[model samples]
Target: MIDALHIPDFPMQRTCPFDPPQEYAKLRVEHPVSQVRAPTGQIAWLVTRYEDIRMLLNDPRVSADRRHPNMPLTEEVTPQTRRNIAEVGRSLIGLDRPEHGPRRKMLMAEFTVRRMAAMRPHIQHTADELIDAMLAGPREVDLLTALALPTPTRTLCELLGLSYDARDIIQRSANAQLRRSVSAEERQQTSAELRAYVDQVVREKTAAPTDEDLLGRLVLSNRETGLYDHELMVGLTMLLLVAGHETTASMIALGVTGLLQQPEKIPGIVADPAAAAAAVEELLRYFTVVDALPRVAVGDIEVGGVTIRADEGILLSFASANWDDEAFPDAATLDLARPARKHLAFGYGIHQCIGQNLAREELHIVFRTLFSRIPTLRLGADLDDLPFKKDSNIYGIDALPVTW
Candidate 1:
C-alpha cells in the first residue's frame, strides 16, 4: 500500500493533499519526508512538515542551483531546452550565498518598505484605472483578464521602465518559459529577443539618463561598480518583469476569489482597509501561490527523523507546510484572525521574495478596492466550472469570470 501510494501516476508528486486525491494528509502524518518520483522520472525527497521545511530552507547545505547534477528533473526537455533552463537557474533564485549575496544586496535597497510605501499611491491609481476599465466593459467579465493580470503588468512595466506596449510579448515569453512547453528553438529565440530588448533599453538609459527607476539604478550600478554586465542586467530585468507581474497578479485574483467565496468576509474587507492587510496574510498562508521551492542537498542532513543524503534533490512543499496541522491548527480552515500568520508563501531564509512588499501592497489595494467598488461581485459560474492553471508552477485560476 505504501509503495502504491508513493508511486501514484501523477505529474508532480501529491504535494498538496487537500486539493486532490485526498490521501496527502495520511502520507504527511505517516511520512513527513519521503522519496517521490517527479514527472521527469527522477526521484526527489519531498519535505512536508512545516518545521522541517523551514529548517531545510534556511540550511546552508541546501543549494537552490538546479544545474547541480544531484538536482532532480521536474520535466522532460531536449538538450537545447535544458541549456535554456540552466541559464535561468543562473539567477539568484537558483544560487546560494556569495554569488546570490551581492546580487540580492544590489537590488535590496530598491525594494525596501519606504520604496514600496512611496509606490503605494501609484499602485492604487493603477488598480483604480484597471477597475474602472473593468466596470466599463460588459457586465459579465473575466476578472483575471480585465483587472488581475494587467494591474501587475502595468506596475512592473512602470517600475522597470519597460514600454507598456511590450507587455503582451513579455507575458507570452514568461508563460512559455515557465510552462516549459516551447520547442528548444522557440525558447532560444524568445530568450534572445527579450535579452535584445533589455540590452537596447540599457543602452538608451546609459546614453541619456532620465529619472532613476529600478533599471536606471542597476545601469548606474554597472557604471559605478562594474559589477553588472549586459547579461546580468538582462537577467535582472527579466527576473523583475516575470516574477513581479505573474505572482502578484495571481495573488490578487486568488485572494479576491477567496474573499468572494466567503461572503461574510466581504463586509470586513470593505469596512477597513487595514483589516484587509491581515486578510492578505491569511490569504497568502491559505493559498500558497508558489507550490514548492527546490533545493539540492550539499551535505547529509536529517530532517523530521528522515535522513537525506548529500547531493540529493529535495522539494520543499510550502503549500503542504502551510497546511501542516502542527504549525497551523485547524490548518485546513481559512482564518483571517489567525495570529502570527507568518507563512512561507514568499519563501524563507536568504531566498525570501524581495518583492513581497510590492505584492502585499498590490493585493491590499485589489481586495480593498474590489469589494468596495463592486459590492455585489460574485462568481459568474459554478466553483467546479472554473478553469485553473494546474500545470503551471504558480497555481491560479485561468479565468476568474465574475458578475456584479
Candidate 2:
C-alpha cells in the first residue's frame, strides 16, 4: 500500500547539479509510479518510467486540463490560478480533444517546412551579426547576456514582425514571468504588460495584414473566417512570446555550459551542421530542462502495475524518462552521437511544444555560429560557482560568464 504520511515531495532536489535527482533511479526500479506530496500539499502520483509516460500522454483517459481540481502544479496554490484561467482562456497548453486538434493544426501552418526554410536565412544572419558585435567588444562576457539571450529575442521579433526596439519590454517581461522567486502580483503584472504589447501588435497587423510574418500570416488567414479574433490572437501570441523566449534562452546558455565541460565534444559539433544537430538532440535529452509535465487522471487506469483512481493528479517525469536505461542506453553519459530522437525533450503527445520547430532553428544556428566564430572561447567561472535557476520551473543556467 502507498504510504500517505511518508510521501516524497513532488519536485525532488538534484544531489548533483547537472544530473537529475538520484531518487528517480531508485523509484524507477522499486516504484515507477508512486504518490508524492505536491508543493500545494496535495497528493499526486509521480510516473518515472519512459514507456508509461509516453503511453499515458497518448491515452484518452489522461488530460492536460488545468481546470481539473486534482491537477498538480509547480507553484504553490494561490489566487493567481483562478485569475490566470479567467484571463488567459484555455491556452494551447491546456486545451484537449476537439478544441486541441483543430487549434494545433491551424497554428502548425505557421511553422510549416516552407516557412521554417525561409526563416532559416534570417536566423543565420542574426546569429552572425550578434557574434560580430560580441567579438568587437570586450573578450570577457556573460554568454547568457551576449548571445544566448538576444539571439532568441531578436529571432522571435523577426518571425512575428514585432518591433526590435521593444526587446527590453519583451525580454524583461518574459524573464520575470517564469521566475518563482517573483511575487504572484509581479508575475501577473509582467504577463499583463506582455499581453498588452502583443495586443497592440495584433491590432496593427489586422489593420494592414500581410503574409510576411507568422503573426501577419495568422491575421490574414484567420481574420476572414472570424475564427481567430483580436483577444484570442493576443493571448496565443503572448504565450508564444513568453514560452519561446525564456525556455530557448535558458537552453542555449545551459547547452553552452554543458558543451564547455566536455571541450572534446565541442569541435566535432561546431565543425559540422549534421554533428551540431545530433549534439543538439543529446543536449536536449541530457538537460530535459522542464522537469515534468503536470497531468490529471480522468478515469481509473492501471499504470506501472498499479491502479490510479479517477480525478487523481499525476506528474509525467520527463527528466526521469529521458534518463531511463531501458529507453536510453548508458543514459548517464552524454554521447553526442546517440540516436536520441526518441527522447521527450520538447515533450510528447498533442500538447507538445508548438514553437518546437522555431526553437530548433534558433538552437542549431546559435550553437554552431558561437563556437565556430570564437574558437578561443572558454568558461569565465567554474561550474560549482555558477548560479543555476533552481527556483524556476524551467531549469537552466542563470548566467554563463566566459572569456575568449
Candidate 3:
C-alpha cells in the first residue's frame, strides 16, 4: 500500500481544460492501480488502466452502492443525504446484483437496439428541426444553447412524459447535482426539488396511465404486475431525466467542438451515414465526458499488479482508461476511422449506461444533420477563451459559439 501521506488525490486537477488530469496519464503508465485520497478525504484505489478498469467493473466483488460508509465520494455527502440517495434513489446505475438486475430488466426493452433503431426517424427529424432553427436564427449563435442542449432535452422530455416547460428547472437541478463546487446542502436541496417534481409527475401518470411513452409504459406495467411503486417510479424517472439529457447534451457540445478543431474529418462524417456512427464512437473515446465511476471493493480484489483490500473505495477513471495505449494504440490521437467501439465512455458490464442505445442514436442523427446542413460551420470564439465544465462530474464546454 502506498503511504497515506504520499497518496495522490483522486480527482486530480487538470492543466489543460480539454484534457484529463496529467496525473492520470502518468499513473496509468507507472502505477495502474494506485492508492489515492478522494475529495471527501477518504483513501481509495484509483484504477487507470483499461484492462484493470474493465475487469474491476465486471467483478462481482466490486459494489456500486454509494451508501457504503467507506465509498470514495467525489462530492461530500452527509449520512442523512446518503440515506436519502440510497433509499429514494432508484437509479439503476447505483444499485448492485439482485436489486439492480431486476430493475434494469424492466427498462431494458425500452432502450434495446431495435427499439432505438425504430426511433431513428424521429431522432433524425428532431435533429433536422433543431439545426433548421439554428440556421434561421442567426449566423453567429451559441450552439450549446441553440442545438446541443435542446436536442437531447426535447427528446428526453418527450420520452419521459415530462412537460417541455419543466426543462429549465430540470436542467438547473441536474447541473447542480453534477457540479463539484455545489455545496452538499445545496445539492441535497436541488435533489429534493427534483424528486418533488418527479413525484408529482409519477403520481399523475399512475392515476391516469397510458403506454405511449417510456414513463407511462413503466407506470402501466407496474399497475399490471406490481413490479414498481410510486417512489420507485419517481426515482427511476428522475434518473432518466438527468442521465438521459446531461450526458448526451455534454457530448453534443464537446463532439461539435472536437469536429471543428479537425475540420478535415467533417466532410467524411457528414457525407457518409455509416462513417458518422464510427466517428461518434471515436469522439466518445477521445472526449470521455464523464470522468470516473465510483465503486467499493466488497472483497479482496487484485488487478493491475495491485490488491485492493475489502472495504476500500475504488474510482475507475474512464478518461484514463480510454487513453490507455495498451487499449488504443496512439490513444492520444483521435482517428474517426479507428475502431473505438470498445471504449468505456458508456462504460461496461451490467452498470453500463442503460440509455446508451438512445444516446448513440441521438449522436448519429445530430452530428450527421448538423454538419450536413451547415457544411461551413466554424468556431466563433478563440479556443483558449472557451469555458469548459471543469468543475462538473461530466466534462463539456459551457457554450459552443459557432458561425457558418
Report the number of the highest-lDDT candidate: 3
Angstrom error of the Cα, residue 237, model 1: value is 1.5
Q: Which stretches of candidate 3 lie over 4 Å from their true place?
A: 88-91
C-alpha positional error of residue 395 in candidate 2 after TM-score superposition, expressed in Å: 0.6
lDDT (C-alpha, whole model) for all candidates? 0.76, 0.83, 0.84
Candidate 1 minimal-lDDT segment of 10 residues: 9-18
User: What tens-digit string does per-residue lDDT give for candidate 1 at 281-395?
Assistant: 9889887878766789999998867789898889888888888878889888888767635788899899899999999988888788887888999999887777766666676
Q: List the residue pairs that clash in candidate 1.
A: none
The order of the candidates by TM-score, greatest first, is: 3, 2, 1
C-alpha RMSD values across all candidates: 2.5, 1.8, 1.5
Candidate 2 Cα errors over 4 Å, as ranges: 85-89
Model 3 misses residue 21 by how many Å? 1.1
Residue-by-residue lDDT tens digits, candidate 3, 228-346: 87777777787788777889999999899888888998898888977899999999999998878888999999888878889999999999999999999999888888999999999
Q: Which wins on TM-score, candidate 1 or candidate 2?
A: 2
Model 2 lDDT tens row, 291-328: 87788888999999899898999999999999999999
- After superposition, candidate 1 runs with Cα above 4 Å error: 1-23, 180-192, 209-211
- For candidate 3, the clash count comes to 0
